[model samples]
Target: MRTISHGISKIEKGISILLMFSMAIVVTLAVAFRYVLQSPLSWAGEISVFLLIWISFIGGSLGLKYKSQAAVTIVVEYIPENIKRMVMIVGHICMLLFLFILIYYSFTWILSPSVSYQKSTTLLVPMWIPYMAVPLGLTFAAVHLLSNLFDIFQKGESQ
Candidate 1:
């Protein structure tokens, strides 16, 4: 479980960083081409937008793995340790439920005929490619949370 947690941390960070860097480069090039060179690339905007969508998902998973999401933890901070452990378990359970729902609906949505047929304007790629990000990202986050839960319950550790 620790090994899986460690591996998720490494891969999540690496993928998020790469996505961020790619977004920056792609958007920069699009801006430069549109304003300076007077040659706007049609695919540039679409591609950049696609990258941004993916970055949000991949980066969001990393945020889950690291517990970097925003929270109002003032109340929890003052709670007892055992109670806190219970709260943490409940919290992770809720997130897992949410991710499961996300994965289910997103997967089905992608399989739907209309959504599967839809394509991007400039890139002309199937819309499912972008929609797939929902399930993929949520799945990653769910696994990370499960890994954390294993450590918490079995090893008596906090996330």
Candidate 2:
């Protein structure tokens, strides 16, 4: 289980790094084409926008995996230790529920007629390809949440 979790973390991180690199390359090429060549690549802006969306969603999933999302812990800090555990469990449950909703609706949206009908203006690529990030990211987040919950429960049982 530990190995599987670590492997997923590595895969997520690798994809995130690739997304970042792709964004940088796209922007750099767009700028260079516009300024140096005096003619911008027609697809550059559209493609960059699509890639940026992918990057944001994928990075967000990795953030959840690492528990890197921003939080206000002031209230939790003031709570008694016993209550803090309950609060944390509740928080995890809420996150799990939110991700479940995201996964379901995103899958539905991906299969909807609108996504199938739409295409990128320049590339003519089906919009669903880009829209796929929604479900994929949510699935990653769900896995991370479940793994954390399992670990928490295991620790409790051991204690």
Best by TM-score: 2
What is the C-alpha local distance difference test score of each model?
A: 0.84, 0.85
**lDDT for each residue of candidate 1 in 47-112, tens digit (9 for 90 to 100):** 877778888888888788778999999988999988988898999999889889888998888899
Give per-residue lDDT, candidate 2, residue 141: 77
Alpha-carbon deviation at 102 in model 1, angstroms: 1.3
Clashes per candidate (backbone, < 3 Å): 0, 0
Off by over 4 Å in 2: 1-3
The alpha-carbon RMSD values of the candidates against the true structure, listed in the order shown, are 2.2, 1.5
Please provide, for model 2 over 67-154, each residue's C-alpha lDDT reduced to its tens digit, 9 standing for 90 to 100: 8999999999999876877787888999899889889999999999988999989999999998998898788778888887777777
The TM-score obtained by model 1 is: 0.90
Worst 10 residues of 1 by lDDT: 150-159
| Residue 19's lDDT in candidate 2 | 78
Against the true structure, what is each candidate's TM-score? 0.90, 0.92
lDDT, residue 60, candidate 2 = 83
